[model samples]
Target: MKASALWPMIIILTLIITACSNNDEASEEVDEEDLEETTEITAFMPEHDEMNFEENSFTKLMEDEYNIDFEFETTSWDGTAANERRQISLASGDYPDVYYLIPWVDQFSPSDLIRYGKQGVLLPLNDLIEEHAPNLQAVLDEDEEFRAMATAPDGNIYGVPQLVECFHCTWGNKMWLNTSWLDELDLETPETHEEFKETLMAFRDEDPNGNGEQDEIPLSGSTMTQKESIIPFLMNGFIYDDLETRLLIEDGKVDFAANKEEWRDGLEYIRSLYDEGLIDPGAFTQNADAYMQLGNEEPNILGAAPAVHIQLFTDNDNQYDFDALAPLEGPNAAYSSYTHPIEQGATFALTNKASSAAQIKSIQVLDYMFTEEGSLRAFFGEEGEGWKKPEEGDVAINEDVEPIYVDIPEGEDETLRNDNWAASAQYYHPVEFRDGIVQVEDIYTEEGFERRLQEATYLYEDQEPEDVFPYWGVWYGEDVQDEIAELETNILDNVDQSAVRFITGDLSLEDDWDDYIAGLESLGVERYVEINQDAYDKYLENVE
Candidate 1:
């Protein structure tokens, strides 16, 4: 009772004593507690079906593990206008605490880094990673190109990149034909250019899709989509460096490949096909929607098209209804494919406004996305919680399947029916997560699985050698970006326009061909190549 009554007086006396005394220890303790609190980070990303992983992302797992909180913001993949709205925001200084700008910002720029870093907007991460991060340092140390690409021309790094080894990206234009159609018509896959001509003719005449009327399109494709590569992939095979898929650095300067003479040969092949009714008249004018629609609804209407895999029918993405044939051989007797490297992972840059601790925490959080456990969690989702791990009791899903991830076995492998791709890949998240450890349940329709099996089982004859050519990554100084862009765009426009005229018979390859090459030269084709070559040389020198 005495204590209760005296409590207020005691508290007042204690407060008075605390206020008058030097209470540095208590204040310091309070400050230390505040410093230990988690930092908040916000990231901006362009929207994609794939990009939506952040909410249920691996980063979230890392955040929970490390006690760092990172928030993400996003924008549309493509707007009505082709202009990048995310980039516009970045340039305008409307940056968040962090940005996951894979669409374009992965193409690191020295100028941007200098501008942002000098303004104290982007913190230099070299020290942070050198101390707090070790795995990322291991990646940089092991990969030379990754180092070159990650480091800015100013001798500093501004972003991170993706470095998975992809063998197929370089030589991608090869498409599979419906060999079932060839068999129905008692025809074979084309070998030489002349044979290719005959094959398309038969495809048109044979009505292979089994429709009563002659509505089968012998060959179909688009020049618009990179993956839709019915044109450049084939065209580049014929030309040395034609069809500037993206800018290429040659001996020393920048160049557009589409303007080369071999490109003319490729176009002429297509023109010959077009003139004979073996190609779709709308090959150039058609959009992706139209092409994809035809693939789904009128599977029989299409006899041939451009694609890396049989999935171009994409309707039966998991099915095997279609088969691939090799690219038609050309005049020079050369067959090669130059695959593009998988692009670096998009940027997840720190904002200038982020405090030093915030920046450090932000990168550490990003580093988590690259962790073995983190990548799997972000890419595969919560295992057992979301995915099932493979067991000794069961054949792993991929093993149980016949053809695995488009890599089918030869001879006896085809007859033996195994449903692996469906059981394994199956529109599964994180495609490269391969056959063991984590497993995807084989959950595909019969039609889907069979079609995929059929497609993989079919033979693709005389497939060309894969060419490793130079593809421009954004380690380049922007000194030549404007000109390379201008020249390449103009060359592409002119090439397609002239190609239509030649294919439509309005212009002849023999007559308009020389003029076209000359026109390309006049439009700075040589200059383009020289610029590319120069850039490559400089790029090589810079790497050393």
Candidate 2:
């Protein structure tokens, strides 16, 4: 566990790579299955400015195990720019052997996989997986939903999946109050919708800071992310739980949730708040860096903003202070938390041109990432030496590599070091299983976590809308995908532009609610529902 000992392990691994290629057992015992000479696998990826892939433990271990070297082609995470670049690459026909961590853009994402698979650009992975990847097959058989999602229109498996077991990862839309401001006025944390409004109003008018200046801006955030967006998810308490960008399966339809009557109700409440000067005027216009500046100033000026957690608003320390408030209980006496699936993004894919060994082995590599042993090694580095498994019930931190870069100020660069050679890798394990090794105590105090538990505990009772119509919850075929995509886009866009208009009082809910519902109808909500029903029916039939 000391720094000096890691060098020996590195030396041994390098020797294995040089002498026997990847695996010692395969080197000695295997001849008929030996891969032909010089199998070059090239990988395409988004930019990892700080990561040095050559020195990564995961890479080092895999290369030694499989004797396969990877060449990576990468880009920064700009979707429009990446898509344009990809089109050029496709046109040029100079593609890499693999694509890793490609994001989901409207035109470029789902369609790309289908298009590429048909063009013979991607290999069918199911039979290869059955032959070469027992671990992956275990996950596929165990989670039929995941298997269903992994298959394409032609019923071929073309890509690997990204899976994580972080239950708390679906960040609830939470309101964080500055306890300092509340104490100055001697107010309890607001519990219900009415109290929340009054509290923001008090922050705006009372000039809670006796400094005789009305500089306090109540309710602020940027367009950075959905949970952090100023107007969308937070407004769910007042309305039909319509979030401006919330995507969900509702009534067996792939329609955007924002077009519902609940959205209009939510917008009306926001309009009222803005009219009373309770919501910050700058929130809509401000950039994230500017917004964060207001949050992190020596004396923070923010009051009652919507955020995922207090950490996003301020640091762990109470210096730039903020506090958690439970999700508001609305007029309907309803409180709910919305979420997508547990998994977040795609990690990688193999090509049709690659050897069968490469295709199956890629899945095997990914499968390892999902295991406690493999995920820990993939993210945290080697187990017995690189990281010390924390004692039961005790969450610990690697003094070597902290998750956040305290090494730099906000907006500065984050440097990643190689765990195989240096100290540790930044990622590891299913987060819940990270209990003994990663502490919530340092991040959230026992008191604060307990309070959060109390808040979301009651709110978790509301099940997902997709779950009620369970059949609509899985993957759709080619025709259904096209119909759903068109309907979802129109529905979301119409609601977003209108909801913002309604909240700014540029449009009125009283006058426009009927028109909005009609517009959603015109955009094809019914057909959207039917596509979902058909897909769900097929998925159910397959299972039965």
The top-ranked prediction according to lDDT is: 2
For residues 20-102, write the lDDT of model 2, one tens digit per residue: 32223212332335543334567666555566766676777877776667676766567777667665555445656566563
Query: How much lDDT does each candidate structure score?
Result: 0.55, 0.57
Q: Enumerate clash totals for all models, in the order shown.
A: 41, 3
Query: On residues 364-449, what C-alpha lDDT tens digit does candidate 1 reach at each position?
Result: 65565556554444444454443444444443334544322222222544332221111111111121333333223342443234
Model 2 CA deviation exceeding 4 Å by range:
1-32, 35-38, 76-87, 102-108, 238-260, 315-320, 341-345, 383-386, 396-415, 420-431, 434-437, 440-476, 480-483, 535-544
Off by over 4 Å in 1: 1-35, 46-60, 76-85, 102-120, 164-170, 241-260, 314-319, 333-336, 393-469, 542-544
